[model samples]
Target: MVGSGQLRLLAGTLCAYERDGLAYELQQALVYVDDLLVVGNSMKGINCLKSLLDKEFNIKDLGELRYFLGMEVARAAQGINICQRKYALNLIKDTIFLGAKPYSNPMDSNAKLYEKCGTVFKGPSKYSRIVGRLIHLTHTRPDIVYSVSHLSQFLANPTNLHYQVALRIVKYLKNEPGKGLFYPSQNNTKVKGFSDFDFDWGSDLDTRRSITGLCFSLVTPSFHGRVRDKKQSQGPQQKQNIAL
Candidate 1:
C-alpha cells in the first residue's frame, strides 16, 4: 500500500500500473525503459502517484510531453498533432533519393514482386536499414504502412527490384514529410475500426497468400487512424482476430 490504497500492476501490459485513492480517484503510469508517462483524470491524483514514485525511485518530471522517442507532439485549442517531420527529413537525407521527384502514390499497382524473379541485391544491409527506419516512421506516417509492409517481406533476400521499390517509398515521402495524425479536442471515447482484404489469391507471388489491411481510429467526428497489414493463410481466424 503506497499511501491509502493498493497500487497494482495491470495484466497484459509490459510495465503499466494503476493506483487508486480515496473518493475513487485513479491514476496510471506507463513505463518504457527509463521514461515514465503519467495520466489521470485529476491533477491531484497524478501528483499523489508521482510523489509515491519519487519516494521510491529518483525521477525527473519532464514538464509537458512535446517529444518522445522521435515523435513530435504539438497541442492547441483544436487538438493534438503528432508527427515525425524531423525524423522523416533525416531519413530522406540519409538516402540517395533526396532530390528525386516526388510521386503521388507510395507503391506501383502495376508492379508485382516475386521472390526469385530479380537479381539478388549486392548490399542487402542497405535495403534492410532503410526499410527498418521506414517501419519506425510508421508510428506517425500510416500512409506508408502498406507499402513498407510489402517491401519488408524481401528484407531477408532483397533484390535489386526490392531496393528500387524501397527507394520509391522514400521519394514518395518527399511529397509531404510532415503528414501525420491529429486528435481533435472535441472527440468522444468511441473507437472505430476498418479493414480490407485483397481478393487476389496470388497477391503474394512466393506464398500465394492474401494480405489483409486493418485500420483503427478514435472518433473525433473525423478518423485519426493507424494501419496494419497482415498476410493470412486462413480467412476465418484472421477475421475473428480483426473483430477483437
Candidate 2:
C-alpha cells in the first residue's frame, strides 16, 4: 500500500514489519505523498500485513483495492485494468473545456510554434494558473504531457501566442475528454525505457533546451521500458516552453 502525508509513517512501519519478518512473504512496498502501493504473491502475506495495520493504526479497509492515487483499478481474470477517467473529467471541468469541441490530436501537425518576441500577455497570471493545473493533470494523462510541458515553458512571461496555444490544448482535451492511458492485463512483464534527444530543437528560443518526451511500458513484473524524445524533431515545434 502507498499513502501521502500522515500515511507516510504508516507505510514506513509496514515496510519495517515486512523487513523483520513480522509480516511474512512480503517482497516490497512503496509510499509516496498519500498513496501506498503494496506488492506480494501470497494471500497470507497481504492479510498478515493488513492485520498489523488494523491492530497498530486506525486505517480503514477500503477492500479489494478499486482505486488508488487517481488511477482507477479493476480486477479481472485476465489481470488488472488501470485508467484515469475521473481525473481527466475533473481537469476538463476545471479548465472550462468540458463543453468545447474535441480535436483529433492534441496538437495540429502543421502548426508552428515560436516565442512571440515582442508580444505581451493580457493576463499572464491567468495563463500561468491554467497551465499549472494542466501540468498536474498530466500525471495520469500522458497524451497531454507534451502539450502541457510545452505550455508551461511560457509561465514566467506568457505572451498572447502562448495563451492561444494553451487554449488550443484545452480544446484538444475537450475533444477527447475520456482519453487516458490504458494498462492491459495480458502483456509481458518486462520493464523497459528509451530516451532520445532533439538537438537544438529549442535553439530558436533563448533557452535553447530541447524538449524531451518519454513513454514507459512493462513487459513483466520485473521488466519495463521507456521511450523519450524532443517534441519538435517528431513534428513542428509548438509555441510552448518549459521553465527550467
Single out the weakest 10-residue window by summed lDDT for candidate 2.
223-232
Clash totals for all models, in order? 0, 34
**Which candidate leads the pack in TM-score?**
1
Give me the displacement of residue 171 in model 1, in angstroms: 1.2
- Ten contiguous residues minimizing lDDT sum, candidate 1: 235-244
Deviation in Å, model 1, residue 119 alpha carbon: 1.0
> On residues 37-82, what C-alpha lDDT tens digit does candidate 2 reach at each position?
5556666656655555555544444456555556555555655544
Local distance difference test, candidate 1: 0.73
- Stretches of candidate 2 exceeding 4 Å from the true structure: 1-24, 27-39, 110-118, 199-204, 212-217, 220-244
Candidate 2 C-alpha error for residue 60, in Å: 1.3
Candidate lDDT scores, in order, read: 0.73, 0.57
RMSD of each: 11.1, 12.0
